[model samples]
Target: MRTILILSMLFCSIGPANAAKTKKPKSEEQKTLYAIGADIAEQIINQFLFEEKERPYVMKGFQDRLAEGKLDIEVKDYRGKIRQMIVDRQQALRNKFLDEATAREGAKRFPTGLIFTETLKGTGEKPTLKDKVRVHYHGTLTNGQVFDSSVARNAPAEFRVDGVIACWKQGIPLMAVGGKAELICPSGIAYGKAGRPGKIPPYATLVFQVELLAIIK
Candidate 1:
């Protein structure tokens, strides 16, 4: 009976110690993973901070905002998902250029780059720089988001091709008086670095499936 009591107490006293010992391995593993993750996170954050530091105006803006003490930021769970959303959006935009380039390569080998798959010898009418042309067009972001469409709204847009974005300057010349074509415009040609707010952001390219309904003289 005394032996049983001593054994029971011994087991009871060691139980917590053993459980705690078991937890150390798991905690150590977790800590190692966390350290690795933190190192990776720090590297990314450091790179971003370095870039931000290069822009004194932006750094000043952040400092000004911080001084104003307007930071009531809430913690969001799913931070990885938020980061992934941004990365995916960027990749979505990038992939459009890749896809367009691939398509253009394939297209040059073919008769026409038209989605209609019809051979267009480009009537070579080549409208003037100041020419006001009426066209129906569908504009989409690389990620398949339709931003605008004169065709969808049942109205044709009046555009002086050259006066507008460079895409129009280059693309409209490829169209005849009545012709349909798709124009994949890179950011350099379309919106450039300064993009229209609310509708478009910086470094945004556009893909326009446009139909030249007429050239209004």
Candidate 2:
């Protein structure tokens, strides 16, 4: 559903380019439509973070569907495949990031693919799954775009050790109270295929900076 909506908006935005090649915009409505399309085009570019090499193929497909009323493949038959391609690409990116993160000095790669690197050592006690703890965390995607941050808000979050994602459940135990660590969670252990909608996409690898503030009694 989301993929369909994105493709629809992107293809609609191609109209302005076709119009530009033909003639100048003469009416207020045409000019407004052109501006709207330009904005949508910009949004799509930023959303995909598409590379220069991929732009031509994307524009060709859009032109074929919108301007030429033709398709090399049936849309209904290929939508699922297209979505899978996106998922696979995201997974590849995640794998690359995981490889680099695990190679970082002091990083520990667990069997579950969670990478933990302690930045600040703590002498205090560590919390178990049964314990509720207070902490501050900054969460981001592989691209370094922050999705959530208790640190930015200046408010610590409190929750049980096992109440969060699998990544945190495993990574937090490695930290003692007052410790800070970087947790790089592979998609399989962090939200997986069904990511937190609107804030995270499917197959996203999450990076987190976590500070264990206290273990609440």
Which numbered prediction scores highest in TM-score against the true structure? 2
Give per-residue CA lDDT, model 1, range 22-132, as digits (tens): 443367778896465456545434223334455564334344444566543432554565456555656564655646654653232122222221124344365777888
Overall local distance difference test of candidate 2: 0.83
Query: Which ten-residue region of model 1 has the weakest summed lDDT?
Result: 109-118
Pairs that collide in candidate 1 are none
- TM-score of each model, in listed order: 0.50, 0.78
> Candidate 1, overall lDDT?
0.59
Report clash pairs, candidate 2. none
| Per-residue lDDT of candidate 2, residues 126-175 (tens digit) | 99998999999999998889999999999999999989999999999999
Model 1, residue 217: distance off in Å is 1.7
- Model 1 misplaced regions, further than 4 Å: 1-96, 99-101, 104-124
lDDT of 2 at 163: 97
- The whole-model lDDT of each prediction reads 0.59, 0.83
Query: For candidate 1, what is the TM-score?
Result: 0.50
Those runs of model 2 whose alpha carbons end farther than 4 Å from true positions after fitting are 1-54, 69-73
